[model samples]
Target: MPDRHVTRSGDDYAEALSQLLPQGQAWPRDEGSTLMRVVRGLSQIWGVVEASASKLLEVESDPRITLDLLPDWERNWGLPDPYYQEPLTIGDRQKALVQRMTIEGAQSREFFIGVAAQIGYTITITEYRPFMVGLDRCGDNRVYGDGTNLMYSDTFVRGWLPVYDPQGNPVALDEISEWPNYGLGPDTNRHYWTVHVGTSRLTWFRCGGGGGQTGVDPHLRIGLATDLECLLNRWKPAHTQIIFDYSGLTNGGSMAGTP
Candidate 1:
């Protein structure tokens, strides 16, 4: 009932345990509470607290691994499309794009097209310049081959997390604060997250865009980006993977219950 009483009771129990321990027992032998166990407990709590968070934060493993299936792609399926491609060259460039999915059936008719719409999208650009190279290293007085190889990336992610009000209206529906961050390089920068309302899912895209060289602040173009994300969400009309990438052990170890 009263929070103070509950807290006091917990404290008293802790005190009793403290007294029962020998003069200095090394704090419960935390070797029994290794980092792996902590991760297991965290994973469990995450599942309990979010309930549905598991779909996005799941882990899997397989003993039959092979060279053909070395790097997994299934985990980051919800990530933005551009990240899947090769790293952008210093001078090379590509147009930025966004898309959205609008739900229209009876159950999703209201929120999907209404309040949930208020949450905006984000577009971000990151220009990882080359370290620099000397003239001879530039190439054997080579033909205009690609300039210094650099890690140029751009990303678009949801700036504000989405939420819908009781009256069926989107509160903060149109803002892309920063670029979505998946990972880097080939499997370098890959990250993704999702918000779910029943069976319908709002997937945000993220990746390095090739626009960093030009000094563009993607958030300023939120209006255009929102339009694109909305389109991607609504009518792609294609079968697509819903998860990004997967990593972890399959056998389900016992050390997953520590913290």
Candidate 2:
């Protein structure tokens, strides 16, 4: 006998479409490959829509009504947060500093578009990058060999950030780390999380009065990590550990230090 494929239901078809197009982007952006992936994903969605139409006609259902099966913020259903902010190229550090400070309390949506218009705009501006990337959590079970809990984060260095002055230049200031899981190193099995939210120069540098600016210091890392641990520990299921990988944006460097 030949193998047979089963048809899918409206809900099942939607789930399949989601798994195929998980996240907003497709991998490996080659021209031909990207086209194929998009076509496949679109076809799957169309199938779901067609099946839904058939079901509606059979039952004479109200098309205006919508059904939400998942939780309010489930990974599959919730809208992914926009990460890009307007990019502004400045002549020097001081002007950058002023522009960076201008976006202090701007909400994510009105920012860069409406608010920026209200205020005079000049310096080069690019949309903000993703605030977070590759945020994940792990679990632990003695018998299951998964006895680990961790959180990790990474951010851009001098990347197009939200803060700016009236002149639209980027400030040389740093971000106060507000990641949920702050501190707890890898060795410990109790609880830990690491967050990277600072800027750095790609190559090495030296100042007459100061020391080298290569490695991350203890004070800043500990402060953020500690706060994260405290926040997670409050829950009944305490988080164990987190590892942040900021190397991608920072050119393999840490920004948690006094410059």
Candidate 3:
């Protein structure tokens, strides 16, 4: 026997179903037969039902594939976090959802490292403590004052999102990029932390930077910003300050499925 016809027109279904009648009804097989016409009409309704059922299973819950459902998903997930005052691109919205679903909160180094891995980053978190003479071991490298590293400015101009490199050089930063943190003022060094994400993704233009390709678009530069600062900031312990270190990127890395 063959597989039953699945999504056919009413006429096809009528023909198949009509055959289920006993052979004694064969005398009514003509087009004028009311019983045959009634079955055909009913099959039209069945055909509509078949068409609906056939397509329903193809629907998806994946945020990227279901663009229209993003608002619903985000709403239910309580997303578009208050930190994101600037409008997000389609790509960012997708990233936000993936981040939300994959993030599991904790204050440990392993927890943050795992969260960063899910969104195309490999990170190492460093916790800080104000250096105390007897409490800290020699060469433990703890700081006495702020121990502040030149990192991304938490204060962005006009509240736009900017990815900060916490371990960046002080010389490279302009006045606007400088974080107005108090130096030699407070003893809250224990609340500060840094994440070294292993190298910058930025590609600056230079005469010999390209591998002999000349026609490449200069404006189409790869950006270093991952918008990761916002995600980490929102989830980090309320008392801790975060610094993203991008000045020490290493070689030979792939971002896909990094966990």
Candidate 4:
């Protein structure tokens, strides 16, 4: 037997309609001409609409297109990617800075200070350092140095001792000189014997001068707690702000207040 074809085209629809007509009957050449034109026009219009809808659906389904899913503050506000161009205005730079800092969990001093206070430590903003960048650089051309000098300085915290053992009796300097320094180099030899007390320091910096201008340099530095546990325990959410309430959809009530 001949194989049966499952798919049909527009010609197949015409042939099937011909079979439905009476014997020797036929449609006029111009029959339903206006209706055909209307349908053809409608098909063309629908094609454009369908293509646009498909593009929108494609964008909506993509996980990387997250602007629509973000809150107003977190969204890009239709701005182009800041990394692609040098921010010319203060607002543009601020937006870029906030976006980056939010991602880094260093958005504000409050966040760092709050976390530090929780762990019996205090943060102090104490020093500033400035550096020069060439004119060809991009973005905020002038970047301030973080207060690493103070953080690494021995005078910042004094309770810590530079002895090998805090509880043991003090050893003579002559005795320490005779003892084997092991694998420690001369620069780190003194540090090898130090006992770290419950004191640490963190330094943070802000980018300060830009706008396509020359000779405009600014500087600022801030301190943060360097306690490993406190720093690690800081409030660093994956999202900078809340935009959705998933609980309302799944639990039949808003989860606005309850922790």
TM-scores of the candidates in the order shown: 0.17, 0.15, 0.50, 0.22
Candidate 4 deviant stretches above 4 angstroms: 1-36, 61-152, 159-259
Q: By the lDDT metric, which is better: model 3 or model 4?
A: 3
Off by over 4 Å in 1: 1-75, 82-107, 114-118, 121-219, 225-259
Model 2 quality (TM-score) = 0.15
Ranking according to lDDT, highest score first: 3, 4, 2, 1
RMSD of 3: 13.3
Question: Among all windows of ten consecutive residues in candidate 3, which has the lowest summed lDDT?
Answer: 204-213
lDDT of 1 by residue, 1-259 (tens): 2112112233344444445546544445242445334434444543344433332233112212111221242222232344333332111211111111223433223343342333332211122222123311232211221222321222121232322221212323331122222222333122222222211122222224222223432221111223234433543224321121112112221110111
Shift of residue 59 alpha carbon in model 1, Å? 16
**Judged by TM-score relative to the true structure, which candidate is superior, 2 or 3?**
3
lDDT of 3 by residue, 1-259 (tens): 3223357778889998888877775537666699889889888987887766544433225664335566787898888787654444444466678778766688887777777666556676655555444433443221222223433322322232332334423323332222323233357977998887764333323333111124643422344435567678877999989877766776434332121
What are the root-mean-square deviations of the candidates from the true structure over C-alphas? 25.3, 27.0, 13.3, 22.2
- Give me the overall lDDT of model 4: 0.31
Clashes (N, CA, C under 3 Å) per candidate: 49, 42, 4, 0
Candidate 1 vs. true structure, TM-score: 0.17
* Best-performing candidate as measured by TM-score: 3
